[model samples]
Target: MQRIISFLCISIFLISCNKEKTDGFLINGNLDNVKNNSLVQLFRAEGRQTVIIDSTRINEKTFTLKGKIENPDMYFLTIEGIKGSLPLIVENETIDLTVYTDSIFASNIKGGKENNYFNDYQEFIKKIRTRSNHLTEEFKLAQQKQDTSKISSLRKEYEVMMEENDANDLNFMTKNNDAVLSGLILERALSTNKLEFTKIKEIYANFDEVVKNTRAGKVIAEYITANANTAIGSVAPNFSGPNPEGKTIALNDIKGKITIIDFWAAWCGPCRKENPNVVKVYEKYHSKGLEIIGVSLDGTPQQKDAKQAWKDAIEKDKLTWHHVSNLQYFNDPIAKQFNINSIPATYLIDAEGKIIAKNLRGAALENKIAELLN
Candidate 1:
């Protein structure tokens, strides 16, 4: 009887062990041509920062990383001396990855369903990039030959291809709303500055609660909320800063005019290039109730002479307009309030301070101002 009881207990213990749930992730990775015992690092993106969570040494071209995660998040697996890093969604499941030196970006990742979906999205983006490169090369050739007809046709084709890509990406995100990858797709769409605020809001609303609650999803949601205030038909957020002469100028002070709130930096090449066009528009329309407030995102701890740089750029570019900067570089509160992640950003506000358009450049800017002022 005693022997039989012991046997029953052992059987129950084995069964329980077999049925035990795994609460953490196990990433089993293999890197071809990687030296044995080489250092490998894992990084997780929190907000705009990439934080290293763990590191391990590859043994015989293989390494394993284990960690607990509350939800799916973006992570990078990097090998020492490797030129590229492998990005994957880390979830609470076993992930099998194979990285090759020659094709690190195309490394094979299996296991987590989120990773699978991410891999698919990456493949689609790769194909799009390849086609875009081909189209660009053709465009250069057409330009060299001065073939206006070919250039027009190629430009139309490129635009259509890009539109189709965007549509497909949106569809994929909609269908996979439960996956973290969907949130990432939406974030990319926001960054493109092409999608309308209403459309972005619609997409965000369609996302599943699980996706919306992820770190990336939270960030996207916040961005959408921030953008809503500055979006077309919405009231532009008011701000105040010191102009070049060290006098405080508020957006409210410039109310009752067609205003272009231009966010730029002296060091930004694109901003510098676009200045002449801005200058042309300002000169043409300043007399017709068109006003511009140039906000400079120049100034860093290393550059104590940022104020001078801002003044010089304005002088050199011939931008004779109300210019302001806190000389806080990227840490400018106005930039943060407006969610100005990129330079060369503009908000066209009407007499009532409602944003009428955004990111208008060159001919677009001129045409819009012409329509409003005339």
Candidate 2:
């Protein structure tokens, strides 16, 4: 009898393991305020579009969706005629969903480890937003009372909260390196510019093969390739665009001993403000074998004349550097190639065209130029 009991225990353990590692997904879903027989669709995001994974009809305000996914990927569940869709991390496990049809974004999605991580992250974000709203109200009160010290204190507190939040996100992403959510998290980290590019790349490389093949992962891979164009120690990609006179000018044509690629726009206020510092740096370093090629992102749909505005800003600011523009705003091919998101950006390269630094400004700009040339 004792031997039989031992055999039974092992059998039970193996059965449980098999159940846990089921082969396909099953979504047991119910809706609030949704009529019976309503249609529900499950969509999977491909490269640039979403393809339907499965669909089911609600019976008595309940529906079930079943499918097989090779990986845990982002899927959206939509109820017919609903204004919003419920986003879920679909894994090969039984998912329990409660659709708040009135506000679909508030829907509850509980499933595998991936969904749990995402839900926990959403809760954290909600708390941060609540604190931010409270801080905004406090700042208004402090302003109305003209309490300078209180205002300063609140500002510092806000900054601290943001820093802590960013750190928390980084920690989560690093801890869940194998999670599909890490792909999205790394993208956010880059867009916020909160972490160094090298650190971001390291974290991205830590992701497992499955996560790296997801849509989000593919997008980040593309961004990494584009951003590498200006990454330090990498040879800068040479580009040519129409100058202010409509004549084409190439980077190789005006390559100097120390070259500065300046990405800015006439409409950018910060660029306008920093023009003088750039002029000072250029005036000091031009005779010292430093050359600057100003790439202007001047075109905007609202602007009356893109080329005229570009020329005026250069002349008014007295920017004597060789300037070029496609007048295509941030859509400029060169800007797209460099993945430049903000203006007043700079890339400092050596005589061999290898990028040495990026986004330097003011004293940093002048000092780097001096160190290289002087």
The list of candidate 2 runs beyond 4 A from truth reads 1-105, 109-114, 148-160, 222-234, 245-247, 280-288, 299-308, 315-320, 326-333, 336-339, 363-374
Residue-wise C-alpha lDDT for candidate 1, range 1-374, written one tens digit per residue = 13222212211100001112368777778887977878899887553357887799989889988888777776777898678666667777777777887866657765455655655666566666667778878989999999999999988887787777777777887788777777876776666677877788888899999988888788788788777776689998899999999999999897647999999988999999999999999989999899999999998556669999899898899888788899887668888778888889999999989999999999999999999999
Worst 10 residues of 2 by lDDT: 9-18
lDDT of 2 by residue, 138-174 (tens): 9999999999999999989888877777777688888
Residue pairs with backbone atoms closer than 3 Å in model 2 (clashes):
none
Instruction: Give TM per candidate.
Output: 0.70, 0.66
lDDT of 2 at 205: 86
Give the per-residue Cα lDDT of candidate 2 at 152: 96
